[model samples]
Structures are given as structure tokens and as C-alpha cells.
Target: MIRALAVVLFALLLAGCSPQVETDQARLCRMALPALMADGAAIDILAETPDPDGRGLAVAFSARPSGPVPERHLAACRFREPGRPRESRDLIGLTLDGEALGEARLFALVRYWLATPEGRAADPAPLGDLTRAPVLSRRAAYALQMALDGLPLAAIYALLAAAYSLIYGLIGRINFAFGELAAAGGYGAAMTALALAGLPPAPLLAAAFVMAAAVALGWGFATARCVFIPLRRARGQQTLVATVGLAIFLQELLRVAQGDRASWMTPVLNQPFALARSGDFVAAATPMTFVASGVALGVALALVVVFRWTRAGREWRAYADDPLGAELLGVSPSATTARAFALSGALAGLAGAIMTASYGAVGYALSATLTLKALAAAVVGGIGSLPGAFLGGLVIGAAEAGWSAVFPIDDRDLAVYALLIVFIALRPSGLLGSRDPVVEGLRQSRS
Candidate 1:
């Protein structure tokens, strides 16, 4: 494992030598084809032409004919700037390359591409023949491809879920602020990457994670000292409310520090490497994915080992199982709770850094959504079950990825929520949970 990790780290170090800062051209290509005249979903005849200068993409689409006269449906996201590759970009220009094209010019350009003998498809068809392979190669490739793409997401979620489980078990209250801590961690990693741009790739990447975790640990310590410790004797609802407030406060702090919009960075070690090959398709992941996965899993494994075998782990488990019983048995509730906060916070922070490295974007707004998802993952896996948390994260991440490909993109979030509801209704104890946590807690209280 160490040898394989060394290889992945070495490769990443080499990748940092290149222009890790993704250019506008690379960003455009990252989202879609540089230049493509393909059929689209909403627009009948869709085409995209890239600006050679790396400015943006010009899109043109003609609506399918409703009658003898063709209707010109309004095309959304026809022109997209490199800055906002996902959103439609409309600009007034006539550059040599298609930096930005107005409606008329876009339509004209599409006509020129499709009408001209040089660019247009021959044989009396606007679209050239697209053949399907008999092996179901594309479908198989797609499923595997989604699984591969989801690996990093899974790693991040796994870490987050583990953190949630740790805190929930230790204190019997959820740390709603974990998602904010993750966002902060990502920001820390990004800032570190920018500052240490002169360093070698491997060191830079390592420093980023270290700094991110350190920062998060520091914050976690602060929250423990100021918020959690003071309320150690309080009820779960009070602690839960306190954490929610902390989450909100952290979000505002991060937003003020980083700003409203998501800060983008050049991808680190994002150059894709092939995982598997089908007839014409290849599933791939970057060196960073390997690095991220290794690091996240290592952290998780280490945590699990500590929880299972260490003296500290035993004490904490004792407290979580029965606070009064543990207090009577010589365990200090104060110390155990404090350590749990620090450890859980650090885990969440590392997950954020992984997100930044893998996705190349981070913002304060990510906190709420991430918290909800990770919480759902924790619940689905058995909220207080350490190992189950990691497993749940893997399941949730893969589910999101699979749903995106198999179903309409719009309904993806809904699916996760639905799954959460199903798990709660059918099996409140979760996969690894031996009994329903609520019922168990009540029984313990009575005893």
C-alpha cells in the first residue's frame, strides 16, 4: 500500500511541474467538446464552435420544425464564457474566432457549417451516420465510467460521514457545523496551493492537506473549547441548536473571507489516466484521485483502528454507551468530548481539501448542502456506527453518480432525499446498527 501510494504521489509531483492552472481553453474543453456540430436535446440541430483564443464557446441550434415553417426556439446557454462554462454567455462581438456570437451570427454560423460541402455531413443527411456497437459496450462503459468518476466524491463523503458518526457517538448530538469546517478546509488547501506555487508538486499538495487539516483542527478545538465544552452538561437539543448556529456563523465568516461566488483554481494532478477500456471508450481517473482516495481511506482506517483498540477509544466508547456509567468508571467526559470534536473536525476539514483538489472549485455555500448529504449518509449507515459511516458515504456517493447518469439530472437531489426517508422509515437502526438508536438510548436511560 505504501509503495503504491509512493508511486501515485511521485506521479502527482511530476504533474505539478506542468501548468496546473487550468486555462480558459482547458476549462471549456473540460466541460464539453472544443468544437462539435452534434445533435442536441432541446435544440433540434445543435452546434458548438470554440474560439481559438480560449475566450468561450459559440452555440447555435435550430428548433425542430413544428409545421411547414420552422420555429426558432430560444436557445439557452448558446454562448458560454470560460468563466461560467455552465451558464449561457451572450456577448456582442465579431472576432475571427467564435469568442461570443449574437443570435443572428450564431444562426448564420450554424447554417454555414451545415450547408457548406466542406463542413456539412454528406449523403443527404445533416447528421452523419452514428453506429451502435453490438456488445452493449457504451452502456457498460458508461456505468463503469460513472463509478470511476464518483470515486473522489465517495472518498470525500466517506470522510464526512465518519466525522459525523464520531461526534454523534461521542456526544449524542450532531455537529451540524462539519460542512462549514469542510468548506473552510478546502479554502485553506486552495490558499496553500497558491502560496506554495513555487514548491514541487508533491510537497505543495502535501502542504495543502496539512494546512487544511491544521486549520480545521484549530477551529474544531475552538468550537470545542468555546461552544461544546460549555454546553457539555446540556441536553442534546440545546447542543444541536448551538451547532446549527455555529454552522451559520461559520458560513457567514467564510463567505465574508472568501466571498459569495465560488473561488476557482487550476486543477492539481487532474490529468486523466485510463482505468478500463471498452470498444472505443475508456474509464479514467487522475493521479489526484488516487492521492485523495489513499489519504481519505488512510485517515478513516487509522480512526477505525484507534476507535477499536486504543485506550482512548475504549474510554470514548464507554462514555458514548453510557455517560453516567463511564463517569462512575473513571472516564472523564470532558476530555473525551473535546478529543472527539478535534478529531471529527479534522476529518471534515480533510474531506474539504479533497473536494478542492478533485473538483477545482470551492465556496462557503457548499456548507449547507454538504452537511445535509453527509448527515443523510451518516444516518443511512447507522449514525453512531463508525465503520458504517464510511460504508454509507460510499453508498451515497455512488448513488448520486449512478442517478445522474441513469435519470434526469433535475431529479438527482430528490433521489437522495427519498433514499434517506426510506432508510429512516424501514430501518432506523441503519445497516451496521444493531438496534434502533433512539430505542436503545431510551432503554439505557431507564436502566
Candidate 2:
């Protein structure tokens, strides 16, 4: 494993040395083209015309038909001038290369040329009137492409799900501080990456993974030992209260330490790569940091496997089945709980770190809401079922993404939460999750 990791790190280093293209525009184009093409009245065309400078082609599109058109399509595009590739300006005036036309212009020209009276007579067809001017710019298509890739959305959901699932599986209690732990992991790894900027991408990834794992483990262990353990010993609702207190305390600490200043993970190792190409549209490259979710999932699985098969795992299962019997067998409940806390905490930390880097920012205030949602996901997955937690995370994540995609729900903070309530009402045990022990116990005792 070490050797393979080393090779990957080395390859990343070599890859990083190569130049990366600015991807924002390319990504946008990918999204715009397909959507534009889908419109009944929308035209799919590209045109290149001349520019005075002659270094690059001057691109422009025609305005779409005006007034109320039955078609719900509106074209949007942007163009960048020479020497300012990063800065996009409106594509005004004439087309460059004097040959290829911007999508809008090409569509317009096609309509005009094809619909000319004499030309129509040659083909024997009546031409429709042009209404709205094409509203698309070169920049618009590029922006569209970025949105369509859905990678950023994917990364966000993946992180949230992983964190919730890991915590729910090992701790058997929602950790309010899970988001903070994720923040810590991300900030910690990001800082480390910044410090080791000279390292290759693979090494940077490895380093971030290791740092995140360490931080998560430490945080989970400390929280469980110092807080949850005491509460569990006392037993009952006290545990829940203590967790809440700990969560608030940690959030405040993070706020004080970092302030409201946005914290971000270093993407020094990230390089842009094209995802797809269709005509003039292309998906931009994104930092590979988002891929860290895979690592998180793998670690989560390893933990589950270890819990299921290892000697320690067997002991844990035995304790869960019969605490007094396990104690008679010489297994220490305190020790096992401590171990579980450590494992859960570490997973949380790793998730936080992955998310921070993936999203590019972390704040103390962000914890409460995310944690609550994670809890919802956990419950939805089915408490005590590790696999269920993972599945639940995906469902929640996907639902959240799909909702955002289809509707403008930004103002509705409770929308996602409301969905959670619905899930609980509809499937109390969660899609694949099992019932809480208390409920199960009551049923068994009654039986």
C-alpha cells in the first residue's frame, strides 16, 4: 500500500508540473450548449469571424427573437478579449475570423439564409419571423457547462453523507461537533498543504488524508472520553444534553480561533482537466481534492469491516448483544466505548477536512445546520446500521442536490429539514436503518 501510494504521489508531482488551463469558461460552455440546443426555437451554431488584432478570432452572436415566444429558451453568452483571458467582456460589434459565427449569430444567419424568399422558392417553404435577439454570449455557454457537470454538487453531498454515516455508525449518538471536526480536518490539511507547497499532488493528497485522519481520531476520542463517556455513565437524556453542550462549546471555540474569516483548503496540487467536449462547449477541469470523498468512503468501509471481523470487533458486537456477558468474558465496556469514540471522532475529522478542502471554505457557524441535517440523514439511513448510514447519506445528498437543481429553494431553509421529517414519518426505521434499541426492547419485552 505504501509503495503504491508513493508511486501515485510521484505521478501527481509530475502531472502538477504541467501547466493548467483556466476552466471556468470551458465548464460553462458545456452546460449552455445542451440546454440551448434543447429549446425548440433555439439554434445550435458556432461562427468565427475576424478581429483587428488578428491573434485570436473575434466572436459574436445575434440577439434572439423579441416578444412572447412559445419557446421558453433564452440564450446567454460571453466573450473574452485578447491579453485578458480571465476577464470576459461582452462580444459586441462584428465577428472575428470573418468565417465562424457565435452560436446566436450562426442561428440567426442560418434562419435568414435558409428563409430568403428566392431561396425559399428554390426549396418551396415559408420562413417564420425572427422575434427576440439572441441573448447568449460566449461566456454564457461556458458558465452553463460548469453548472451541468454537477461535480461541485456531488462533492458537497458526498462529504455531508460520509460524515453523518461514520459518526452514526460508531458512536450510536449524533455528534453535534461533527461539522467542526470536518472544518478542523480541512483547515488543518489545507494549512499543511500550504506549508508543503513544493510537494507533488499525490503527496499533498496523502498528507491531507493523514492529517485529517489524525485530527478526526483525536477529536472524536477526546470528545467521547471527556464528554460522552461521563454522560453515558450517568445514563439517559443526560448524554444528549452533554453532546449538545459539547457541540456549542466547540463551535464557539472555532469561532474565537478563526473568527468570521473564511478558512479554505489549499489546492496547490489541483490541476484543471476537461471532462467532456461537444462542438465548442467543454467542461472545465476542477481540483482533484473533491475526489477525496472516495478515500472517506473507503476508510468508512474499512472501519465497518474491522468492526465486523476483527477480535476487537467481535468483542464490540458481543458487548452490544449482552453487555454483562461481555463483561463476564473480560471485555471492558469503558475501554470499548473509548475505542469507538476515537474511531467515530477520527471519521468525523476526516470528513470535515475533506469537505473543507472540497468546498474551499469552512466556518464555525456552518456546523449547527449541517450537523442537524447529518443527523437526519443518519436517522433516515437507519440507526445502528453502518451500511444504511451510507445509503441514507446518498439519498439525502442526492435529494438535496436534485431539489436545488430543479427549484429555487434558497429562501426555504426548512425545505431540507421538512423533507427529513417526512422521511421519518414515512419510514420510521429509515430506508435500511434498524429501530432504536429502546423501541426494539419494548417490542421484545412485550412479545
Candidate 3:
């Protein structure tokens, strides 16, 4: 495992190095450095030449004061000289102990790069040995830093994905408006906290969090009653279209109401949670997260209690199995469907509120995209499985955050869709979707 990891690290290191075909310093001098450095200005490379053909030598590329430095001329500058006495010259040494380089030593190297009559010939030689120490040291430090930072980012993604997976499993469809719900919850809590600016942290946080969660739950109830129930009863392609339309409408309404502006959901308990390995990456759970978690737990507990202990729970299970039969026995399918929608929406709103706090801002136009991602999470985790929805969300969140940190890949939106497609191909029924008996029947019938 260690060897494999070492190989991967080596490959990444090689990738970061300047490509052999074209020198980075040449490009910088011709286009970049001239803009910053006055003519005759010189800078030392902290390390040896990165070029394979011109390794082992300290590189110094400087230009004479004047017009644009031609690319061909810049490229032709010599890298380092060969077989120089590494011990005697002290040409490659750096002062680490706050000891400054004497004027004579600095002038000697500067004059060398200018290649004036005062300095030696600008010969392109591989570095001797002293240059290698700092080069390897700096690279090792950078790689270590990245590895440490990456661990928590990965953990954050896992957490969010798990939360989304739970939501998808229960809802059976992506709540396109889910992100907004989280955003709203977060913003509402933040705003409330701001209103009570002088209050103690505990009470202020509680008040804001409660308001956010309550608002989300209310919205969830309304969506179930006003949008989802009617559409589900219609039980046609129009139902899907209608839900999508509602999502669009909600997003537009929020945009228009807010005048299409950016807003921040400021932190309540602004204290940072520090990690030992990476002191830089500090985060604290927002009030919204606490509210959402409470809501999630309460709902789960309610489901367990109702299902295991109550008459209503047994009837609901029967309804799920056979709606027509349950209705004939006087269990109302309409009521059950309405309840499901309310639950799904409420949880989604809670999540949205949390996101608002996490991001520290919210915008109207982002709702539809949020829904799409939530759906992707649900699908990836296993559609109609609550645990799966939560897991899916975390996976997507982590993947997105992690990729941006380590890679220079573009178009994150495209990556999410690609991931969804791969998941579908690998597990068509989703994480918890049942195998289609009808598909088998059709095959048998055809055979």
C-alpha cells in the first residue's frame, strides 16, 4: 500500500513539474515577468532546474532592460553549469538562519545571469548537489499539506451525501426545491440571530434555529397539500411536469420577491472548530445543522413510533402495499399521500436552511439546480430509500468539494450528471429500488 501510494505521489509530482517541451520560466519572462520586474531585476530559483535535460543546476533567467524579450531569445538562456565544485563555490546555498547573503555573493550570481563580461559563461549544466535539498524539501512539505487538508474535505462530503441519501429514499423523487429549503432555514436562523444581536448565544441560536426549522416545516406542509398531493392523484406524466413547473415557479417567485439579489446567512455561534492536522480548515456546525438534525431525528422517531406502536402505522403500511384495498377498508390514500409529501418537504426545508447557514449566502436562481443535485443524490443512493438519499447527498457534496481542492477540472455540473449516469448503469434500480418483476415477466413472455 505504501509503495502504491508513493507511486501515485511521484506521478503527481512529475505532473506539477514544468513540461520538458516548453520551459515555464521562458513563458513567464517573455509574457509574465517583464510586466512585474524592472529591466535588470534578478530573482534566484530556490531550487534546482526542473527540466529533465537541465537538472541539478540552480536556474536564473533575467532579461536586459529594454523592449519585449523575444520568446526564442528567452528560451535560449542557459540553465546551469556542469562539474562546478559544489563545496567550494557555495553558489547553490541558501540562508535559512536569518543570515543575509553578503553583497559580493549576491552580485556574483546576478552578474552571472546578466552574462556580462564580469560573470562566467551562461553554460546550461545539470545542478551539482546542494540545490537538490531544498527542491525535495519544499515539494515534500506541499504534498503533506494537501494530504492533511483533503481528509476533512472528504469527511464533509460523506456527511452531506448520507443526509441526501436519506431524503431521496423517503421522497421517491428529488425535491428540486430542497436546497432552497436548507438555504432558507439557514438564512432565517441567521437573520433571527442578528435581530437579537445583544442576546446570549444559546438563546439567540435556539430562537433562530427554531424559526428556520418551523418555516421549513410549514413550507413542506404547504407543498404537499398544494402541489404534490394533487399531482400524485393525477398520477400521469403531467404530474411530473407539474412538480417541475412548481419548482421553477417557486424559484422565480423567490427571485422576484428578493429582487434577485445576494444575501448572507451570517454565523451565530461564530466560534471555530479546529482540527489538529489542519489548523487552517476550521468549521463549526451552524444553527441550521442543529435544527435539521433535530427535525430529522424527530421525524425518524415519529415514524418508528407510529409504525411500531400505533394503529395508523399498520394502516399506512397496508396502504403502501395495496392502496385500493386499504381505501376500501376506510384508510384514506389521499391523507397518506399528503402526509408523505409533508414529511418529504419538511425534511428538505430543514436541509435547505442548514445549507444557507453553511454557505453564508443564498440566491433565488439556485433552487432548480439544487433540486437536480438532490435528485441525483437520491438516485445514486437508491431512490425511495431514506438512508440512501442522505448518503447520496454526502457523496456528491464530498466529491465536488474534494475535486476542486486537488484537481484543476472544470465544469462541476457536468461531472455530477456523469456520476448519475454511471450509477444508473451500475445499479439501475438505485440503492434500494426493488428489481422489476414485470421486466422478467416480459422477458419470459417473449421467450
Candidate 4:
């Protein structure tokens, strides 16, 4: 793993050393100038200057006299929308090319220059249709938007991770099928909403949440009772493999029953509340984001209180520390395990319902991605640690949002997995994981 990471880092360094690529303005100049210049005229692009707002660029070019052209000619070409490379070609103009410049080309050039910051500053008439309100800058807007969008998602991840951690902490076994429980929750809510269409918003939403939790709870209980309990005496690997197969089975079952189409929920909190604004750019969040995040946080906090204060919580912890001892003491291992699964499923279901509402859609494929991300959170924060899971979810969400600001949209997932790899390499035990007593003993002995 270390060697693989080293290789990846070395490849990234090599990529950084690659040659610089041409700018959009330069490429556009090369394509447009030749067609407008006199036959055999030597055209050279001198320099390209971006407008103040960075939305457009002015290209200066020199054309040597050739054929009918008798003297050196210099002219400037401007692009109104520098980011839109395709549209830029139709907006170029030539000066020294003289009579060779066609009416169509001249018209395009005029529009391009008029759209530039300099041109707009000179005469705002060209952009009369555009918004003149104060708004955030483009880059700032994008970054803020991503951060806001990631908050609720992070909360959902926290809930999912917490569920996984709870189950693992109690049972010392990974429930690979937990992701399917989440998906089932989401699908349950969606179906309920459909069946209860035309109901008041409050009742509809309440029904969705209740139905989702109930469905997920039932699934978790059955899995524990029918599958996990029977395998309790079996090897750990056997249980792990069983859960994986179960996960795949559940995913396929959902796919066949729901069809491949994504089910979309009606917009719950669709009203946008702008947080920052400059010119045309705006950073905003919806009510749903805050509400969902708040609910997830509340659930996590409630669980913390329960575990710290309640009798059942004490029993659960006792079982986690030593199941055999707890069972010997009359703490019904089966009952505790069942309760843990049910509680975990309830949390997972709630998370799924919130996520589906936030995204407005749910599908079978989403389960795998969510599972992987939640697992990454659990591992990075400290496997089997609730606080660590929440912290890790936030870290992953922030990293993903921040990386998206600088990298291509398609590479976002790559950035996420890279973060996971780095965390694994640097802190295999996770951020909050307790040190292994065996490893500590080994170190002490060596000393």
C-alpha cells in the first residue's frame, strides 16, 4: 500500500512538470485570423490580454504584407465569453487584414468587443439584459455553493457511519448490507409519498419518515434474527461473506422491483435563501439542507446521551466490551444484538430519507456509493467510534467540496478516494481509534 501510494505521488509530480497548454484566446486567434488575412499573409499573435472581470480577452496580432497587402498591419480581436470557446470563434475581428474582412466576421468581432469588461465599462448598453445586482465572484460563488451543498450530505454520511459504527462496536462484525438498509428506507419513503399524494405537506413528510424507519427496522431485525444469529457460532469471515452476498442480493432485488429508473421525491424545501451575492454570482442554501443537517445532528447527540445515561446503554456497552461475560451475567445477548440492529437501521433509514429528499431522487446504484463513502468516514474517523464517525464525515465532505473547487467535476470521486487512501496510509487506526494493547505490549517488550 505504501509503495502504491508512493508511485501515485510520483506520477502526480510528473504530471505537474508537463508542458503548459495554450489558452482559449490563443487557440481562437489562430483559427479565426488566417481566414481573414490576405493570401499567404504571415500572421503572428503578439499577445492576449484578459478583461478586468476575466470573462473575455483581447488578442493582438501582427500580419506581414503579402500579395495585395502592401504594409505590415496590426489589429486587436476580442472575445466576450472567454470560457465559451465555441462561441468565441464567431465573435473575432481583424484590423490589418483590410478588405479581406467579411461582413459576417466584422459583425462577430463587434459583438465580442462590446461584451468585454473594457467595452462594457465604456458603454453598458451592450449588457442591459444582464443582472446589475451585487453578487459574489464566480470562483467564490462556486466554492461557497459547494460547501453549502456538502453540509447536509456530510450530516447524512455521519448518520450512516454512526449506524455502521454502532453495529460494529457491539458485534465486532461489519454489516456489509447496511447500505441496502438505507436504500430500502429511501424507497419506502418514496413509495409512501406516492401513495399518500395530495395529503398536506406536514402529514406527507411525517408519513414518509415513519414508513421509512419502520421498513428499515423490520429489515434489520430479520437479518439479525434469521441470518446473523445463526452464524454467530461460525467464523467471522463466514459472517462477513454472508453479509456481502446479502448486500448484493438486496441490491438486485430492489433493482428488479423498482426498475432501473430513479425515483424522485417532490421538492420539500425548495425555497432558496441567498447567503452572499456580488454582481451576478450568488451563494445560497435551501431550508431542507439546514433542517436535514439539524435532524441528523440531533439524532447523533441523542444517541450520545442515551449511551452515557441510560440502563440499556450500559447493558449495550457491557456486551460490546465482553459479550460472553455479559451473557453469563444474564444480559440476553440475542436481545441486545436485536435492539442494536434495530436502532442502527432506524438511523440509516432516517439518513436515507433525508438524502433522497435533498437530492430529489433515489436509485439502487446510489447505495454502493453511499456505503463506500460512509465506510470511508467510519475508517478515517476511527472504526467503531461514534464521535470519530461524525468527525470523519465532516472531513470527507469538506475535502470533497474543497477539491471540487480546484479540480474537474468528473475527477471529484477520484479526489475523495485519494483522501481515503492518504488517511489509511497515515493513520490506519483512524483519527480517534484507541491504540491496540497487543501492539503496545509488543513495543514495550522490544524496548
Candidate 5:
């Protein structure tokens, strides 16, 4: 495994060093530079990079003869189609002297540069308004857009939380490696899709899901058998600490195998469905989002039913409620624990596959954040309650989406944890949770 990972990493490093291909933006900038300069002046455009503000390009160039260079020079060129009745209005421009330029400056420069009689005659309306084109009020559309975006994220969180809750409730040990299991599933699906690129989408998708679930299941079983089972006689905290190390090991392994760059999944069910439209403002949901959320909800419901009605689920509940008693009643502890781990991993893998498909990419960095969020959801939803986990995920997702509109992107996680803290302080049982035994015991001890 180490040798295979090393080889993959080496190949990725080689691919990154391969020759660069010129993009359309680069081509446009190159073509427009000559028009912006003096008629016969020799100028060479050397480098162009996106400005930090994302408004325009930062361009570097040197004028020939090496004479006194101006501290600042700005020019814009509006390229027009030669034979078209309707002229093309796209503008490209540069600001020299190590300063970033705005779109407004680019538009203004184009208008001023084209002020000559012939230039004006070629295209009238050179000083087109650069301000935002009029659109319906975004305020009215925010709620719907938030719902469309948040619900899918909520579904993903719920799936992950379910996985966490299942293993923790049954084993009384938190499996920190579950997130890596999900990442493994994502990589599995991505690899399978790449391997079977010639297959039709339906079959390919089905195969990818199977591959993802199988990979995660195997990992979960091995983790239980090799790690947790061996430490079964030890304290739960010891097993938890071991799982943390295991999580780190798995993450590093994936980083080596998959490389640092994100792996993009095939675009499946990604067509956008516009929910509401008023002028330029629109609320939309992609088919991918809907499909993923639907699958997550269906899976959650199915699991709920299985736990409530099935014999295997009864065995699981029996083990969770009282492992010693269950073992005495002829339930195989190792088999039950393995089954729990497998189911949890399968759910996590399914979630990962759907999430990667919806977002179109997966990376090693995603594992830690996803695990944290799912763990938070489980705790907030009353850790052992399946319905509560789903509800908690929705709450977290909605809170994040809504708060992002008001706060900086970097502060969004703070809002989630703050909410969790508030909930814990006020009601340790969570929204749907019964009184927590740990908290109750503490209170009784204090009394």
C-alpha cells in the first residue's frame, strides 16, 4: 500500500509540472494589447494574472528601447466582430505600476480610447453602463435560494450524523475514522467512474455507488476487527484515542494516494431548475442537489424503518441498550458490533458518493471538516436519536446558509459551534433527546 501511494503521488507531481495550455482569457489579453498601445511602438506583454479583487487582470509588460517608463499607464481595448451587424462589446484592459484595476476603470478607458471620430463611428455607445444591470430585488429571492441550497447540505449532514450516531450509540465509542471512511467511499466512486468512463451514466452511477459502499464497508469491518475489537476490554476513551490516530493515518494515506488536488466526479444530474425568476434575479436548484437530497432522505427513512421493524435492527438495539445482557441472551458481540460498523460505513459512503457527485469534487481536506460537522449534528440532535440527527443537520445547514449572508465566510463555523454551545448550556438533552445520563449523573453527584 505504501509503495502504491508513493507511485501515485509521484505521477501527480509529474502531471502538475507538465506544460501549460493558454486559456481564452490569456488569448484575449494578448490580442487586445497591440490595439491599446501606440501604433508603431514596440511593446511586449510578459505576464497576466488575475487581480486579488477578482475585478480585472494584473498585467506586466515592458516597452522596447528601455526609455523612462511611466509610473502608471492604463488602457482598454474593446474588440468588435469584423462582419457582424451587432458589434461585440467585450472589453479587456490593463493597469500598470503594480496596481489593481476595477471593471469600471476598464470600461471608462475603453470609452475614452474610442472617442476619436473613426473609433466612435465604428461603435456608438462606447461608455456603456458598467454598474450592475437592473434585476429584481435579491431580498425577495434570498429565502427560496437559501432553502434550495441549504436542504441539500442538510441532507449530507444528516447522512453523516446518522453514521456517527449509529456506531457511537451501539458501541459507546466514537469512531473518529468514520470521516476517512466517507472520503474513501468518495475516492472509490471517483476511481470507478474514471475506470468505466465508456459506460452509460445509469450503469456507471450504479457501479460507482456499489464500489463506494463496498470499499467503506470493508474499511469499517477491518477497523472494528483490528482496532476496536482488540481494545474492547479497554476503556472507551482509549478506543476513541486510537480511532483518532487511525483517522490521521487514513487521511495521510488518502492524501498520498489521491494527491493534493481535488478529484472531480462526473457531472451527473447537474442541470439547473430555476424555481423563481424576476428579471435577472433567479432562484434555482440543480438536479444533482435534488437527487442527492432525495437519496439521503430516502436512506434515512429506510434506516429508521429498519431499526423500528426489522430483526437485525432489534439485535442492534438490544446490543446498544445492554451489551452484556444481549451477549448472555446468545447475541454474538463481535458479529453485532461488526454489523453496526458495516451499516454505519455504508451510510457514510453513500453520503460521500452523493456529496462528491453533487459538488463535482472531493479532497483530503474535506474529511476533517465533514467529521466535525457531523459530530456536532449528532451531539446537538441528542446523539442517539435518529430523527433528531436529521433535524439537527437541517438546523445546522440552514443556520450556516442564513448566517453566511450576514457574516464573513470564514466565521460561518463559529456560528455553528456557538449555536451548539448555546443548545448544550440550555438543554443538554438536545431538541429531541431524553435527559442525558452523563449530565444527570453529574448533577446527582453535585447534589
Candidate 6:
């Protein structure tokens, strides 16, 4: 396992060093930097946007050159197509301090802007690592930012909820211990990153995520094997009780390992690209959020594909629909349950790694909150419905974000729980739940 992780980390490192791919803002910033530096000017933007006609990108700039007189100017990076490669689009000129320079003049520089003394200066130490592009709008920009914040959260909750749904569908039982399992994954990620403190950020994070997934996968599979499998012949309440006990045990074990304190990893990708701007707020999103969301999306697609097409998935579905019939048809219950639990654990681990990478802190006590939220998400979406779980996560995450944006931040959790309560009270079957969840439960129980 260690060797495999080492290989993965090495690959990530090699990938990172392979090329310099610039995001739109990064590209504009990179182009603007040398020109701004040449004139000893700094940029403060109210808005930056691509041309509606696709000519190039333009940014409103307040240029503060190293002169007694500071001036404001309009700046743009002209390109045939904004999305094309560097060699494709020739920049016309970036005007700084009333001087216009062509791409050749700007591109040919004595020193790289990223390494230069003037370009390196930022308000804070960390902002130096980022490029800024702000779009002006009070409502639209703030909404965009909220979406960015909420999407990552949605991605995380969706992952957990999906795990819940997967296990529930397989065994007709919920693994309440998944939250603890996620925390274990976070611990694994943190410890791995801490151990590899000397590695570059990208490789370090890659290794951490891999470790997190491995740890969670092992624990999840073991939990199913040791705790849930034996209780297969027992009542639902008994399985629930067993898993809850397992949850508590895992939490306490982790807490003891942590010496009752959270372990923190050094921040990775803390610098955000300024996406838009409202009056006192800049809608900022880091690359990490997008990455997390993408992973969730990818996982969701993979799950969908597996469930719809694979023979194992068909067997699992048959077992879920009718256990005795599936068994008679030659499906091995043990093998099916093991694979299902392992996949669920891997999903949990991915969630943990994302949470850690985004927040940079992990604690054992977080297990309960995570588990409860994920459970609520699952219940709200449709306990055994994979698509519903993802949708429910989005609903909860969006609600939390919107509430925090407009209302008091401290009562955010209250709002989330209140929403869950309303869902439970009004639609116990959830948004996309079975037509008769009560009937399904009774049927499963009798069988």
C-alpha cells in the first residue's frame, strides 16, 4: 500500500511539474504583470470580464505606478479566442501608466513577474500566490460566490449521503458509523501530509488523499465484516445500535489518538481566484472547491454507470429487491455486501480528504455532526435513491450557504436542522423517496 501511494505521489509531482496551464484570471494576470511591473504600477480592479463578442478580456484597473501621480486606466489582453493557447492569441498591448506595449515587448522581460520583487508584493503573505480578477455586481456576484461555497459543501454531503444510500440499499440497514469512518479518513490524510511535510503541495495533497481513501476503505470494509454481517439475521434496531456503538467507539479511539485535540495540516491552495465582487465582498473561490465538486460528480457518474451496467451491480440490485431470490439465483451475499461496504468506505474517504483539504483541520468530535448531516441529507433526498442523495446534499448545502449569506451565521446549523425537520414532518419519504417507504421497510423487515 505504501509503495502504491509513493508511486501515485510521484506521478502527481511529475504532472504538476509538466506544464504551466493558466486559468483565465491567471492568464490575464500573468500577461498584465510584466507590463504593470515595467511601469512600476499596481492594479486594483472593480471588474474584469471577457468581451461579450469574444475579442479578448478586459479589466478595470486603478494603476498606482511609482510616481507622485497615480492614475486609473482600462486594461485588456487582446486575443482572437479567449480560451485558446498562448501561441494562438497575440496580445495587442497592455497599457500601464499611459505606455502601450505589444506582446513581444511584454513577453520579453528581464525577470519573471512571479519572481520579481514588485510583483511579489501583496496585502498579505498568502495572496502573493494568487491572481485577482473581480467582477462587479451586488446580487449576481454574491450569488455566484455562494454557489461556489455551496457546491463544494454539496459535493461533500452528496458523497456521504451516497455512501449511506449504497449501504442502505444493499442491506436494508443504515451504517450510522460512516461519519466516524470519514473522520478516520481525515486523520489518515492529516497524518500523511504531516509525515510528508517536505513534499510540494500538490504531491503532498495527492498522497494525503490516497492515504485517506485507503484508511477509510479498510475501516469501512472491516466494520461491515465484523459488525454488520453478524447482525444480518438480527433486527434493524439491533444493527443500528451496533453501528452506533461502533461509531462511538471509533470516535473515542480517534480522540485518544489525537490526545483530545484536533490536528491541523498546513494550508494547501489557500489562495483563491477572485471571481466576482459585491460592495464590500469579493466572491472568491479556490481551485480546491472545483476539484472537490468534480470528484463528487465523477464518482456519481461512475456509480450510476456501475449500477446500470455491471453484472455485480445487477446481482446487488437483485439481492436488494429480493434477497432470497438473489441467493437462489447464485448471488453470494457475503461478496456482495463486502464490495458494497468497501465502495461506500472509499466514498467516505474521498469526502474526508476533500473536507480536510478545504478546511485544513480535522477532529474526532466532527464525526457526529458529519454523520448526522449526511443522514439528514440521505433522509431528505430519499434514503435508498442515489440521485436523490446528491440532490438532497445540494438542497442542504445551498440552504446553509444562502442562510449564512443573508442571515446570522451562527444559526446556520439551526436552519439546516429546521429544514430537515420540515422535510421529515411533511415528506417522510423524502423528495425522491419510494412511494411507500413504510411499506418497503415492513417488507424488508418481514423478509
Best model per lDDT:
6
Q: What is the lDDT of residue 14 in candidate 4?
A: 60
lDDT of 6 by residue, 1-447 (tens): 999999997986576544222243334444455345435466555445555444455555565668656566665655534333344224444555456665566655323442356544432212222344555778888889888989878988999999999988777788888888888888888889778654545677779888998999999889878987777788548888898899989988988877678877655555476776666567778777877888789889999999999998898788888777889989998889888898899889988888887887888888889998998899999888899999998888998899988999999988899989999899987898787655486447633
lDDT of model 1 at residue 206?
A: 85
> Higher-lDDT candidate among 1 and 5?
1
State the displacement of the C-alpha of residue 437, model 1, in Å, after optimal TM-score superposition. Answer: 7.1
lDDT (tens digit, per residue) of candidate 2 on 87-129:
2222222232243346676454334443344322331101111
- Sorted on TM-score, best first, the list reads 6, 1, 5, 4, 2, 3
Worst 10 residues of 6 by lDDT: 122-131
lDDT of 1 at 411: 90
In candidate 6, position 419 carries an lDDT of: 88
Q: What pairs collide in candidate 5?
A: none
TM-scores of the models, in the given order?
A: 0.71, 0.64, 0.55, 0.66, 0.67, 0.73
RMSD of each: 10.2, 12.7, 17.8, 17.1, 15.1, 11.5
Give model 2's TM-score versus the native structure: 0.64
For model 4, residues 258-327, the per-residue Cα lDDT tens digits are 9888998765544454676655666777767886787778888999998999988988888777676778
Candidate 6 error regions (>4 Å): 1-134, 198-202, 436-443
Encode model 1's per-residue lDDT on 1-447: one tens digit a residue: 999999997886576554332233233222222123234322332444444433444434443323444443222232333222332122223332334445676555445542355432221211211232223467776787798777888888888998898887777678899999999999999899877654545777788999889889889989999998898767537877899899999999999988999976556666454555567566666677778878878987898789889999999888877787889999987788788888888898899999998898899999898999998889999988888898898889899999998899799889998999999999887888667556467334522
Those runs of model 2 whose alpha carbons end farther than 4 Å from true positions after fitting are: 1-172, 268-272, 277-290, 409-413, 435-439, 442-447
Q: Against the unseen true structure, what C-alpha lDDT does each candidate score?
A: 0.71, 0.56, 0.49, 0.72, 0.69, 0.75
TM-score quality measure for candidate 5: 0.67
Q: Name the candidate that leads on TM-score.
A: 6
Comparing 3 and 6 by TM-score, which wins?
6
